[model samples]
Target chain A: MASWAPTVLASDTLIDANAVDYLIVGLYFAVVLGIGLMARRQVSDSVDFFLSGRSLPAWVTGLAFIAANLGAVEIMGMSASGAEFGLPTVHYFWVGAIPAMLFLGVVMMPFYYGSKVRSVPEFMYRRFGTGAHLVNSISFAVAQLLIAGINLYLLGTIIQALLGWPLLVALLVAAVVVLSYITLGGLSAAIYNEVLQFFVIVAALLPLTLIGLDRVGGWGGLTDKITEAAGDNPETAPAAQQLNSWPGNALSGFDSDLLSVVGIVFGLGFVLSFGYWTTNFVEVQRAMATDSISSARKTPIIGAFPKMFVPFITILPGMIAAVLVSEIADTKAGEQVAGGTGGTVTYNDSLLYLMRDLLPNGLLGVAIAGLLAAFMAGMAANISAFNTVFSYDLWQRYAVKDRDDDYYLKIGRLATVGATVIAVGTAYLATNFSNIMDYLQTLFGFFNAPLFATFILGMFWKRMTATAGWVGLVSGTLSAVAVAFLSEDAFGSLSLGVIPVGGQGAAFLAAGAAFVVDIVLSVVVSLVTRPKPVEELKGLVYSETPREDLVDADEASYPWYRRTLPLAGVALAMVVVLNVLF
Target chain B: MPTAPARATQRRHRAGALDIRNIIGGLLAAYGVILTLMGLLGDPETDKTGGVNANLWAGLAMLVVGLVFVAWAVLRPTYVPDGGAEDPSAD
Candidate 1:
């Protein structure tokens, strides 16, 4: 098991900020606050506050959709994985994200937007009655709060690393800043800030990548350096093997413990990626905020363009860090040093060390500010999602029925505050996890893996019954937990002939198992039970539903090349090219 | 469709130059300019990491993109439609 204790790097090597860095960071906060205050007038009702009045343009919503998922851990963790695993890590972007993003936009958006569900859980209630809704809402609320806590924990670590502030002080400062804007502006404010953060992160990290490449004599040089380092250490994997994107070579059979082609294709590409990009409210909420049906449908499609190139910024840094920092060493029992200052580095600190070593004062400040913006955007997405689910799905249905719009709006705002307080408590609890990213993936396995099966059956199959929905969800979650516990010795090995694959691979297998279990149970139970009537299932089930919005004949008369199909075609080709090239 | 006066009122409520996109674009452009200036005239001590002045180039790129967003917002502002009511079934 990885060590849970925080690594203490040499104090002398810590980041030293000049006046310019502080000024830039201060300016960023001021602008974010100003945007929030400016949006206050736009939010006069619950709909406006919760869903941006569903009037956002395509470009804005598109960028925010991807940005909402760009949590601090994604940036740091992907880079860390890059350093540890090498080229195979890029699968998280290409195979794991693009196809699923496209599926959400092209296949699912019509139902989600036309049916007009306020949240994903609301869709559950509409489709399967109260039982499914409660199951989805309660699980989703807890998940969002846990995700918010993770975001806070990461932000605190980054702030403490950069400014020498105490972790508690850092957490409090971030909470105050995020709450100020989010409570004031609501979803609109969060989305606007998310877009801004998208730009900031790209601007900051692109430069870092270019500089690192230049110093290393470009990509070819980087590969050579890593290879040379690996050659010198017999304990490490071969440099050529590390550089290759494919799972195994002639020398070693399916070498990586973290991934295999089978696992990648099924576990991540099909299951986890679809489960996340398709059903997760944090991402879908952004798409749902667009001004029109077409715009909402186009949101994730547009977002996929930038998403295809994100690996260059997020994962390339890890490759650079691997070449710059030393190799992994086990200094004591249950403690492994992955290499940096003080003769040890946790993989999580890879991005931190890169910033310290490469960036100067003015740029360092901008990068730090960008990182902070990412953290806040991530937190704000979860908080806003939590409030929406709580107010619409839980509170409106259960706590206070027949309330005015104003009353619900008040409840929504209060829920945001309450969620933040709960998140703060969870942040303290998160300290026990050995790796934040691993813990998060396990959480996804427990909730979203099965949730996707429920959605697929509910949306496409008209025969799926209400009883089947709740049963599938509960059984799927239990099976996932059981598999995970069995895989680990900590829970005593009850492995049912399934070999343990560590890290992402383990999460993938658990999720894949859950998906299979959920689908089977849903199919069996649904076959035996009475399905909802076809007339009532209109717009919810694809076969029974008529398209709500038809394209203009003038627009339809345009050539095939002018349509969205071409864009999707190009995206598919690019994914193929990337996988082959890498 | 709703009446003209109601539509006009809805449009009026949504109308503003201070749209979130405009605000974000303006802020990014302003910061990009600052970073560009710092890269050009500030201390040359950053060369220890590498000879490339990353701030200047990154700032220039951000400035151009930010201005494009500003232009997009100004030229094609979004207005709320008269019939843009939530689908009652959504609740």
Candidate 2:
């Protein structure tokens, strides 16, 4: 979309490099390596290597969770959004992410950590049967791989932007450095690094704010001047609007509301919140090897708190940049706002400018280190998770002999390397994706959406059979993927049946279709299909299990649905109130 | 019931979830607010070089001072820091 003008505005260029930058960044990296090396001693077995043997204190896991999820997109996207958009765009974090995560922590997490299952698909196998697990494992793994690749790609691009390094070399170095650490240290190393990243990342942002405030007109002045400049000018108002919001003018005519917003929030949130976090292989692996239910359960909730704030770190800056565009251009805010974006200006670049122009030396590097930490943590977490799942679930399931730790660990490392290569390669092809959020959301919707319905039914409804689980999973995934690619022209409209729709409409339609189809087929098949032997059902039923049991036997002690009724009522009220208010 | 990390690890596999001590939500809320306010209010340079605009010299100075308030509010560093789960075995 950009010609690049073959020119680097010194502002867009790497404006400064000094000892202060290196010192903070160097210290942050050293601490991570030190922690990684330290954690290596802890990684003697699969459980310890992958899940920290379920012993992580809540705070470390919490910060690590944030660090893992916080990637290049958050670093650039949030700031870029804040700098470009104004106030309302904060909804991306607050309105969309926060409430959902809170709901997950308060209501949903208890169910997950209580479940005591290692992965999402493992729960499906437990609840439904192996068939559903088989279908979803591949799709879900691919989706995670896509996330890993996209993140790897963003890291490489950021490297290129920061140092003018060749893209592939940067990608490989980052991937290898991180992979080596994770291979040696596993989840403990990842979390330890994440803990360090959390502090350094914040340290970086704090200074950027100071310099930007000091060097510019200060916070209030920046707002008043921009408001004054934009108030009188119609041409500047829209750009001001984009710079201040998520539905940016950068890509012209891109507007969305509840249908879109709900679709996105619940789509990304419920799927990952329930599917990946609760039942999936990668996220839940942390819970699996936890020493006890409290750490397993509490660690994730602790993690959720930071998850809610992460969007704040990056989204606001972009919104602010959008508001201050005219000031940056030495023109009336209106003039800069007038042209209105047509996908020409990459929003990611705007964030980098704010970082270059706004942040001071030491903090900038630390913030950059935060970006590096996120990339490393996310990839490391993904690799650790995927390799374990592949080795334990797939490889071991099919392999002839019981393999040695070295032999299996080697396989896991190879899986990590293979996945990393695929991911870096995938980044080059993300031109089709408009932005990181879009790419992340779209894939999550297609792959994870199916697991949600299947998992819910599998967990609660004892009648659900393996056949039904398989059918439900297949329907959910296939339908979501099919729907993602659909357009108005692809499906003819009907005034009596439906109106013309686009983007996520298809994804929802697919999910709905799958949900209904799964329900019907599961009922029919559960009745006709063979059921698990009664003794095997003992796990789902109570038989001397701990509280973290995914299916509690003492249904009467706390009839979950009955206890959850009040919470659901409150949730419905909030949604209705928000629906009205928004 | 002692609420120490040692007690926490002793019963890590016990009956309840990891309690966040009721303060995390507010911490997150404050974090969101500071970021939003800064984004809305920030405008350091009117010129490309990021020099303080003459008219806003006083306001800009106060804004820098105001950051002290933001720091005071946000950097309080989450009371009940680890939700009382500071166990060596849990690490």
Give the lDDT of residue B17 in candidate 2.
Answer: 20
lDDT of 1 at A510: 83
- For candidate 1, lDDT tens digit of each residue in B1-91? 1121122233344544136556656666766787788779886445545777776876787788768877776577766545443533334
- Please report how far candidate 1 places residue A397 from its true position, in Å: 1.1
lDDT of 1 by residue, A152-191 (tens): 8888777777776777887888888888899999998899
How well is each residue in A1-582 modelled by candidate 2, as lDDT tens digits? 122333344224343545544544454455455455645654566656655666655556656655665665467555644444444445544444445444544444545555555555555556555677677767767767777787777777666666666777878888877777777677666666655556546545544554455544665665665576456555543535533433332321224554555544444334433444444455556544444444444445555546555544555455445445433332233232211111234555555556665553433555566667667777777777777767655676556348776676677767777877787777676545544554564565556556767766665566667788787777666665555445331122311223244433443444454555666667787889886666555445333234445422342465443233343344445544543442
Candidate 2 per-residue lDDT, tens place, B1-91, comes to 1111222123223311211211122222322333334334553333432553321332233244434533443444233323322333321
Runs with alpha carbons beyond 4 Å of true place in candidate 1:
A1-13, A248-259, A326-344, A489-499, A548-563, B1-17, B77-91
Model 2 TM-score relative to the real fold? 0.72
- Alpha-carbon DockQ of candidate 2: 0.05
The TM-score leader among the candidates is 1
Interface RMSD of each: 9.4, 11.8
The ten-residue window of minimal lDDT in model 1 chain A covers: A325-334
